[model samples]
Target: MSINELTKKLKNEAYSSLYLLYGKEKYILEYSQKLIVQAVLDEGSADFNLSSYDMEEQPIEAAIEDAETLPFMGDHRVVIIQNPYFLTGAKVKQKVEHDLKKLEQYLQNPSEQAIVIFIAPYEKLDERKKIVKALKKQGEVIQAEKMNVQLQKEWINHASKEANVKMTDEAVERLIELQGENLGLLIGEVNKMALYVGEGGVIEPSIVDELISRSLESNVFTMVEHVANRRIDAALRICYDLLKQNEESIKLMALLARQFRIILQVKQLKAQGFTEKKMASILSLHPYAVKIASRQSRAFSEEELKDLLIRAADADFEMKTGQRDKQLSLELFMTGIHKAKQTN
Candidate 1:
């Protein structure tokens, strides 16, 4: 089920007896867990009704037993079964033997008085297993996967509303540009920005520009973008700021090379008729990154990208081998790219 559907059901207090939450997105998985906990137990009953067991250290039967147990002074109990590796194809060293038969039997007729949630933080589950099959038939399976750019924007809006602030579209785009697609960082930044703006305030692009913290990698991306646009002075200013912040020149060179490499790959893939979505999937990058790289790739020829990469590599070697001052080498590289852009 989608997270929105789950939210709607939970909002109506329609609780499921069995829920299998599995995915690689920890933020969504964690958020979904919190929602379930809030929906299942009140603050007063949570301590007595909520039970968690790690399958790595405890057997599945223990969790099942808890699920079957009656709630303490409440109408429902929440039994969280964590790290049920047996549900997946992964080969984890067994510290305790799980009674799959007991689990299978419990799945057939789960307790109506309790909610059993399997928190499987895995990319995929072993669907071939009988227990997995039984669980699929018996429970609601919610896959907490990564959100696309649109979904991410929606999340930002929702979070901003919850904080009693409004985020402009430009502000949302800027936040993603600066912070990438890390939901955790985005939400934290959103909350902080909301507090600064106060209730009923609107967060604009300028507010994001002033308040958001740019990572080293993000700064490098901006620097390269400036280089692509032939804004050498702006690019150098960012580089100097990093130097002031005690960022090593060698590390900066490495990040520059990585960004250029991505641009080169995106350019080649685009030439091969691959869409941005396809490139994102192939490159294992966020779609927004692919979008930025695609736009940045347009400023340089494939030959120019290759030349920039070679120069970055040579500068890296020189700095690491002590053949040149690290900061000077990085500056020369930046200037060199700028000069190349000018001559073109």
Candidate 2:
């Protein structure tokens, strides 16, 4: 099931014994988790009923043991096992793998008294694994995809509403420009803006610039989005305007280079178990950039991306050295993208 479906089920009291939630997008899945927790366990009783486990650092069997033993004075229990990919590796103790099938049997008919949730983002679920089959039959699986510029706008609107803050479209655009387009950074920036602006939700460009000095989902980031998405014509226009407005060519290239570098890093980071939010911070790129970069990275073959990075490095070298005619090279570089011929 999708996050929407899962949310609907939990909201409607359609409880399941097990839930498998994993994806590039986490906000919606988090919402689903909360809804499920709320539905199955009372707010006042949450402390006793909810138990979480970090299987990457520990054993899944230990968590299962905790689940088997019910909470005191609670009608139902929730056990969340996170990052169990280690279970299939040699690093995992043999004792757990030998009894993996037992976990499957439990999922096949999980106790009515408990709700089990597994979170293993950025890792594949090997259906050949014993528990995977039972989960398919017994629970809901939710895949969360990260947001892009368009969706970023929707998120901004939603976040402002949540914070009881108001934002102008220009302020929203400006905020995104500074941050890049990652939902986490955008949300964080918006929260800051909301606080500074007295929760009036009144966001102006000047106030936005002052309050949330860091945002990845803003207009300049959108400008880059137009280029990476291969809306080259529109991107060219934006580029020309930025130049006209005295935006530094070196700075622009730095921005472009940072964008592509993040794309490459996001691809690798996502593969290495880095969460979307963590990838942005570690890459020192905007979360919004990481969000789209991860998706766009799939559009290029690993070789293509590597080649593009080489091109960016060359462009950066020439442009910075002033060894080449600036406008001509930058324009040629922009046009060169069409040669790649990939439409995002």
Candidate 3:
């Protein structure tokens, strides 16, 4: 199940006998776990009914034992099993043994009074494993992967609704600009905004600008856009702003070079008939970011993208080698981009 679907189910108080929560996104996984706990056990019963076990220290058998045990003062017990590394094929740092057969047996016939949640913080589970197949067949599974842009926007809307506040379109965009795709950070910022704006109030661009601090990656995106649009003055102003904030010019140049390379890669992939979705997957970038970069890439020829990357590299080398002032090197690189843009 998608994270949103699982969230809806939990909200509806539709409890499952068994759950397999695995994901690369720690925030989503953790949030979902909390929802399940809330749905299964009441606040008063939580202390006595909730049981947690680290699979690394205490094997699956131990958790299964706890699951089989009756709740002390409640009708239902919640057993949370963390770091079920056996679900994935990745090698562990230390050899922590797990009894997979116990989990498989529990999956075949889970406890009616218990909700066993297997937390696997892994990118992908080993589907070929019998335990995995059994769990999938018998329980609810939520894969908390990085959401695409539309889903992300929907999530923001949902969060706003939950907070009893409204976020304007521009506010949403600005929040995304400040927070990027980290849902944990975004949610925190949203909660603060919702409180600041008060109940039923709309969060606008000014509120966002006042509350949120710009991330380095977000500024890099802006700088790249400015460069792509040949807005040299705005681009240099951003650089100066970064420098005033004690950001190293070499570090900024590296980020610019990385963005340029992504643009170039996106361009080359597009030329070879790759879709935006495919390019995003290939580049391991957020689809929204890939979309924005795709638009920026069209403003520059392939040669221009390469020229910018080369200039960024030259600036990096000159500054690192003490051949030029660090700030001046970056300034020169921006000027080079302007000249390249003019020529192109």
lDDT of 2 by residue, 258-342 (tens): 7666677788888899998898678765555576678777755666668777887888789878889777677777778666756
lDDT tens readout by residue for model 3, 1-344? 87667777888878898999888877878988988898778899999999899877877778889899999888889999898887878878755677777677788999999999988888899999899899899999888886667766777888899999999988888788667888888888889999998999999999999989888888888888897788989989989999999998889989988988988999999999999999989999987677778888888889877777777778898999999999888888888888867875
Candidates 1 and 3, the one with greater TM-score:
1
Question: Which residue runs does candidate 2 get wrong by more than 4 Å?
Answer: 1-5, 26-35, 86-98, 128-130, 165-170, 197-200, 204-206, 215-344
Off by over 4 Å in 3: 2-13, 228-233, 244-246, 266-282, 298-301, 339-344
Best by lDDT: 1
User: What C-alpha lDDT values do all the predictions have?
Assistant: 0.91, 0.72, 0.86
- At residue 340, give the lDDT of candidate 3: 69
Best by the TM-score measure? 1
Provide the global lDDT of candidate 3 against the true structure. 0.86
What stretches of model 1 exceed 4 Å from their correct place? 244-246, 272-275
State every prediction's TM-score relative to the real structure. 0.90, 0.58, 0.85
- Root mean square deviation (Cα) for candidate 1: 2.3
Error of 2 at 207 (Å): 3.9
lDDT of 1 by residue, 1-344 (tens): 98789989999988989999998878877888899999889999999999999999998888888888899999999999998899999988899999999999999999999999999999899999999999989988888776788878988998998899999999999999898778878988999999999999999999999999996768888898898898999999999999999988888999899999999999999999999999999999888778889999999999999999999999999999999999999999999998988889
Q: Which one wins by lDDT: 2 or 3?
A: 3
